[model samples]
Target chain A: MADASYPDGLLYHPEHDWAQIDGETATFGITWFAQDALGEVVFFDPPQVGVQVTQGESYAEVESVKAVSDVIAPLSGEIVEVNADLADAPERINDDPYGEGWMVKVKLADAGEQQGLMDAAAYQAQLG
Target chain B: MVAAPSDTLRRTALFDRHVAAGARLVPFAGWEMPVQYAGVRAEHLAVRARAGVFDVSHMGEVETRGPGALAFLQRMLSNDVSQIAVGGAQYSVLCREDGGVLDDLFTYRLADDRFLTVTNAANHAKDLAWLRAHADGFDVQLADRLDDYAMLAVQGPAARELLAPLADGPLPARFHTAELTVAGVPALVCGTGYTGEDGVELLCAPAGAPAIWDAVLAAGVVPAGLAARDTLRLEACFHLYGNDLMESRGPIEAGLGWCCKEATGFVGAEAVAAARAAGPAERLVPFAFTGPGIPRQGNAVVGGGEVTSGTLSPCLGVGVGMAYVPAERAVVATEIEIDVRGKVRPAVVADKPLYRKAA
Candidate 1:
């Protein structure tokens, strides 16, 4: 698993999700804190493309050998793409949570929802 | 889920070692215990392919002694007490009058007139109280040995080799026990383990645990916790007390009839014999998922039955567990569907001991 890091470029949610914002679309994945607590990821059940997700609501699920957890939506959007590779290798969520482990590509439903999310520094501060 | 305050929980003698090893401690059976260290899958596979040591001090013990020990135990435990020779170990279920399983136990006969029975941590107080209540006519003496010993299980393919060097005498063989000085500490080394691996379980003074733990670790035995133990025992199809063998379930349905000798006339013998003669309505069987999704305890079977214990078998790389299903549908390879939360999962009844070493 990747070392604990909340990169400055990503916006974080209180639920431990991160959004790599890029204009109207952003890639979504769980933060390092989330994966580390859940242990090794064994299964990733992704949300379907074209489905709408509301901020602060669960959109998908991830499972470890011992537990199953909800993947909360950090910002409201319609899922444009899902990480198909994760169906075979879910441990990517732990290995590189920000890069290859991204769960979905979301086209923002309301770009204004970004204001409610925390910056990387603010997220790390809240963790303490 | 909210856990009870940590102050109310008990700690084993090896608590410090677990914390130093960076284990994830959680509350279990009124004790704060290490659920995992490093990771569950890693620790589980280590025991299967190599060796791992576990601090099982949370389990309680009862010492039965005096001239009437044999007769007293024969009346209490389901197994025939006459079959156990001195220095032998035997397994049996503590049952209620109605054939319900009170707890499963392993009794070691240290001498012709003395024996030690180990009880599951959660059921210790209840088991002890029950035994004391039933001791009216028996002349045997019972001692609660919960705080008198700290237990450690060293298990796996290479477990013996690791302990052999530290022991002053030869380690006991399977189903046997010996008083040995291991790692400069006096311990009763019993050749028995729940992980279905070749191993020894040591019972020693609580203060002596650290030395033995360190010696075993230095000999290359990885530290394992309750999570790995659960997974390993499940893969072996062993009945876990709370999950598989409950007070409402009889030995016949739990597939433990072999350990019960009807002629012994133990507390629940009559009911158990009746269950055997008439047959059980529901039987516990091991099953494996054919595809994605893992099953969990409390998950309902599609037709009838319930999942009591479930986990992803590290060796088989699939979701496997035991469920109580109707007798008609308990045959091996029978198709079954489990409702995991809301989604339904497809599985098939499989053979016991889901993982086996190649001969």
Candidate 2:
């Protein structure tokens, strides 16, 4: 009975990508807004842990009960960790998206990339 | 901004209208169709409570005219077409050689020997080709009416009130048709709908459909899009052609055995009978989530067998969906789990069409 609606604490991209930064490393996943749009998440095709991803580039695929959607990366970086947990529990993105639903952690090429991304409030305004 | 590649998306005459209304258009069955005008759940609830209009012009309309039309259709569709008297419409399915469903369609008996078969929009070309291939030497003339007309469905409890001003009279009493003029546009109004509500479908000239649609909207009919249509159909437990029943499964497995006639020798009759005799491997049944997460399509169905179409039922207040499970697991109240996000959330089997708002 967890809300699948939007959650704060993560920056969002119009395409549903989100970025959470800790120093040079940034964790990324689809926002709750994206999960809500996708309905129910059933499967996730994640990129490898060491794969390099660019800002605004699609690096993963998520399948819902309705159709397949792409999961993009928010900031250019090398993927430090891929949320293996999502491979089995994709609904975590729908349940606690900003928390456990984190899809990947990246070693950022540029920490300034976060500034270009929309904050939670700005992303919510974009949705409106 | 650069536009998306112009895919061969066949659109209805109301395409411009939908776009102007800010509809999110997606490709559905080779057509650039609207998935949602506003949102899925909102439009869905609008139709359930108020009046909603749907531009179902994408659905194919094929006429079986000439002297032997009824007889030809009798052998073509699964439901008893003979029972559909003139001016009445009946819902039926066109089956394949193996008794598998090619498409679920609506048969309208226009006259003594002239009938119209309204099929799914995506299957228009395919259905026409299949019908033509099977229709050889039958004294019946099959003409694809796809280009000649536009179809609009006005659905909900207040549908009658909203459309009566546009029509010649009240809704033609459940599947019955009435020749009428809406917004000065001539149309055929039939009391039939996919949403399982008391509604009517108006068929008229492609250009005239928009006028009628606008007038009906002016009369308080809400313009609903494909998102509402889908959820409404799902809640009604109405079977979707490509999602629920396809060439891979039959009426038996889809829990549509009631429509299969024993006396009729229609196309795929043999296969249907054989399948019935042998018993189906799986059955389509409704399942609701007892746990947190929602279950979606293609997600593994555990404790049953195979999973089919799945989605979150906003009305159910929990995750409700459908799957092809073993006969034993398909039973009402049977407990199972939908493999959502790799976690198996417990669910209970319920009857199809989880939401029914009367007839």
Candidate 3:
């Protein structure tokens, strides 16, 4: 598993989810702290590409060998793409939480939702 | 689930050792326990390949003594107690009059008129109460040894090798016990384990546990935690109390009839005999995922039945579990579908053990 590090330039949700916002679109994945707690994620159940997801709601499920956890959505949007590679190798979530572990690409319902999120420093502070 | 206060949870003798080893502590059966050290899969594989040690101090123990010990146990336990010679260990279940399993246990005959029975952590109090209630008619003395001793189970292919050097005397044979001084501390070492491998379970003074634990670790045994212990027992098709064996199920339905000798006239003998003759409505069987996805406890079987225990087998690299299916569906290779939350996962009934070492 990778070391605990939350790269900057990403918006964070208190649920340990992160988003890379680019205008009206955003890429979503769980934060490093999230994956570490989940422990060597063995399975990732991704949402369908065209499904609409609500902010602060569970959109997918991730399982470790011992337990299963819901993957909460950070913001409302229509899923445009999913990280299909996770189907074969879900450990990427623990190995590279921010990059190859990205869960879904979403077309934002309201980019204004980003205002409720925290910057890296603010999110790290809330964790404390 | 609400988290219990850390101060309210009980700590074992090895609590500090686990924290120092960087183990992840979680609340289990009202005790603060290490769920994993390095990781579940790593520790599980270690037990399968070499050896691993587990602090099982949270488990409870009941000591039965006096001249009526043997006869008393015959009526209390499901197995034929007379068959167990001194120093021998035997497995059996404590059942209610209706054949409902109270707890599965291992009883070791310590002497001609004394025996030690191990109980599950959560069910210890209840088991002790049940045993005591039935002691009125028998000439046996019952003592709760829950806090009198600490337990450490060292299991795997090289488990015996790990302890033989530190032990002052020869280790006991399978299903037997021997008194020995291990690591300069007196211990009762039993040649038994639940990991589907050759191993020994050491019972010693609570204060002497650290020395034995340290000596075993220094022998290169991995510090396995509850997570690995669960996975390993599941692979071995061993029934876990709350998951597989419950008050709603009987030993016959749980596929534990082999240990039930109705002729012995145990507490639930009549009920067990009736179940054996008429057959159970449901039967528990081991299974493995036929494709993708992992099965979990409470996942409903497609038509009839429920999964009791499930996990990703570290050795087989697939989802494996035990489920109670319609009696007719218990045949080996029978196909079944499990509803893991919403998804339909296909699985097949397998042989008793889901993971076995290559011959």
Candidate 4:
């Protein structure tokens, strides 16, 4: 987590979010850059499963010791699952942002929304 | 979208060192200061358990000199300035004539006819102008020492031990100061700190600060930042200028009556005495969450008060904060509910220090 990483095959949002796509489902989480900027996250108020999420809108809130940041949704979907483990160990967001740190899994409302996201290389370039 | 540059923010003498330490720099009181290095919890724990060094160079200093210095400061400061012996440090508040707190400061008696008062960065300019405007009748000279020195606070149980070897002579005891050569640089080491920990605050020349800072870090002192400083001070129940202490409230209401000597006849003495005799309507008290949820500034209390400062105490592992509530309900065991955002979080008024060292 100390080094900046942007895994390929993951779509990136300008707000520093990532979406890992499956058949019709996708896992969403903030990117390494976002987590690094937020410092050590102490709290993650996860959104409830079965809630609707709109792309470009905040679905959850992440709090560090000194600040609170809004975690935006990268794509529109119906949230099917929330990462309950983060309730007590929000630091995972900084440790494994792409894996266990994934915030929510959603059933995509429109897979076509992926067109708006950037690839890993493009996201890295944006970060630069 | 790209973020805008913080070009207008001022930098301290140790800014480069903070950057090299991978600190999270943030704008504080118009200065680009390190909010945290490593992490707030880590830095906070480091200071509590061992020694931690802080770049407090942003804090301002004012020098009052001349034969009338004592009388002039006695009129301006809320505490009994006449009692501070040479080499002694006294904490006091500057108040408006109407009893509003201007700023909380620590004045060190450097000499019989000279004193140095450290001021909050945000209120330094206003405090300077206020002192200068009132210098008409008094034969005192006020010099702004804001840029003349860089401040570093080495704090914790092992603070003295960590700083001793590099010091040319012995460090000052608590609430005292001594001039010494630290890391080969001339410095005024004051035995004081905001963190309720044993420590010395070093005021050194700007040019020599980087070397001193590096030497302290080299001595195993964890580099802490403003975020850790806030948590540590809050755990100690120390009043933060903008939060716990404010112009809208007098020192008595802010639980600082012990430092206020109305007989000294300082500015706002009459109003403070009146407030003291009659008692303040609201009293600032430290509180901790009985349940979950961190209380934050401006969060409304269920009753007639509001939280002024709050955080998840790194030491206590619980939500702790200070609030101003009706004096009647400020008792230590009184239960209070804070409206955090929209949800009500249960809390109880605790002792002055919400966190204490384990026995």
DockQ for each of the predicted structures, in order? 0.50, 0.15, 0.53, 0.42
CA RMSD (A), model 1: 1.6
Tell me the spans in candidate 1 whose CA falls farther than 4 Å from its real position: B1-5
By DockQ, the candidates rank as 3, 1, 4, 2
- What does candidate 2's lDDT look like per residue over B1-359, in tens digits? 11253657788888888888777777777778777775566677788888788988888899999877877887888888889898998888889988888999888888998998898987888888998888777889999899999999999989998778766655689979888887889888888998867899989999887788778878987788776787677767788888888988888888887888847888888888887888888889877777656566678887646556566565665667778998766689988877865768888888766886555
For model 1, residues B1-359, the per-residue Cα lDDT tens digits are: 22444798999999999999988888989889988898888999999999999999999999999898999999999999889999899999999999999999999999989999999999999999999999889889999999999999999999999899999999999999999999999999999999989999999999999999999999999999999999999999998998998999999999999999989999999999999999999999999999888888889999999999998889988889999999999999999999987889999999988878889
Could you tell which candidate, 1 or 4, scores higher by DockQ? 1
Estimate, for each residue in A4-95, the C-alpha lDDT of model 3 and write its tens digit: 89899999999999999988899999998889888878889899999999999999999998889898889999999999999988988998
Supply the global lDDT for candidate 4. 0.93
For model 4 the local lDDT of residue A31 reads 95
lDDT of 4 by residue, B38-143 (tens): 8898999999999999999999999999999999999999999999999999999999998999999999999999999999999999999999988889999999
Q: Model 3, residue B339: displacement in angstroms?
A: 0.3
Q: Write the per-residue lDDT of candidate 3 for residues B74-141, one digit (tens) a residue.
A: 99999999999999999999999999999999999999999999999999999999999999978899
**Arranged by lDDT, best first:** 3, 1, 4, 2
* Per-residue accuracy of model 1 over A35-128 as CA lDDT, tens digit each: 9888888889898899999999999999887788999999999999999999988999999999999999999989899999999899999988
After TM-score superposition, the amount by which residue B38's alpha carbon in candidate 4 deviates from its true location, in angstroms, is 1.8
Compute the lDDT of residue A30 as modeled in candidate 1: 96
**Residue runs of model 3 more than 4 Å from their true location after superposition:** B1-5
In model 3, residue pairs whose N, Cα or C atoms come closer than 3 Å (at least 3 residues apart or on different chains), thus clashing, are none
lDDT tens readout by residue for model 4, A77-105: 99999999998888899999999899999
